[model samples]
Target: MGVAGSGKTTVAALLAGRLGAEFAEGDEFHPPENVAKMSDGMPLEDSDRWPWLGHIRDWLAEQAAAGRSAVVPCSALKRSYRDLLREAGPVRFAHLTGSRELLTERIQGRAGHFMKPAMLDSQLATLEPLGDDEDGFTVDVFPRPPEIVDEIIAHLDR
Candidate 1:
């Protein structure tokens, strides 16, 4: 989990492949209205996100019950959201963090995604960095993607 443009999707995909786990892109589960709102440069309200979050939680629960490993890329920016996922199952998060400037540049360069760089501010504003009590590892997004994947796997292996 991380802010927009922090490479959560990229890292998650690589990690999933390495772990032989299913990759679930949370954005693909967004409701059309939510997609439309985001495409219009609007941030999603808590009310708009609750149902979507519930869906993700359910999916995680299902995967966990099936003894299936999975990598999910989601912007669980709030503690409450993280708590919801935690209640759903046992999971570890690998947070990709980077400076605003770097993230802005990355977001701008990204194409074919409904989320726009203009929405980055809203995402950053809402993001609450992972706390000490959270079950996860935090990695800065300066290194290459393979390095990031290696770091995450190493951390998890520990």
Candidate 2:
């Protein structure tokens, strides 16, 4: 998981392919109201996120119940958010990180996404990173997407 333009979607998809796991995009789980909020370039508060995170957690649970491992790309920007998701099952996060300039450029280059370039700062402000106790590893976003995925896979193998 990572901020907007951190290549979370691209890297997650690659990871899914590598692991032969089911794939889910966190954005797809957002309620219309959440989409509307982000589409309006408004930063979502924690209140705007709980229900959405719950939906994501449910989806993860569904996949696990069906005996599947899945890769989901989400802006799990806070430690509490990740903790809530862990209640779903054994979850592993792969956080992608990069400089602000790179993130901003990537966001601006994209089109038709609900997340606005303007909201990147808010996301950065909200992000707590994958803490030491969190079951995850961080990969630099500067590498090629496949390379980043490979790094994540290497960690998983360990």
lDDT (CA) per prediction: 0.89, 0.93
**Candidate 2 residue lDDT tens string, 87-132:** 9899998889999999999999999998899999999999998889
Clashing pairs counted in every model? 0, 0
Rate residue 32 of model 2 by lDDT: 94
- In model 1, which residue pairs have backbone atoms overlapping below 3 Å? none
By summed lDDT, the worst window of 10 consecutive residues in model 2 runs over: 129-138
Q: What TM-score does candidate 2 reach? A: 0.98
In TM-score terms, candidate 1 sits at 0.96
Question: TM-scores, in order shown?
Answer: 0.96, 0.98
Cα shift from native, residue 150, model 1 (Å): 0.6
Q: Which residue pairs collide, candidate 2? A: none
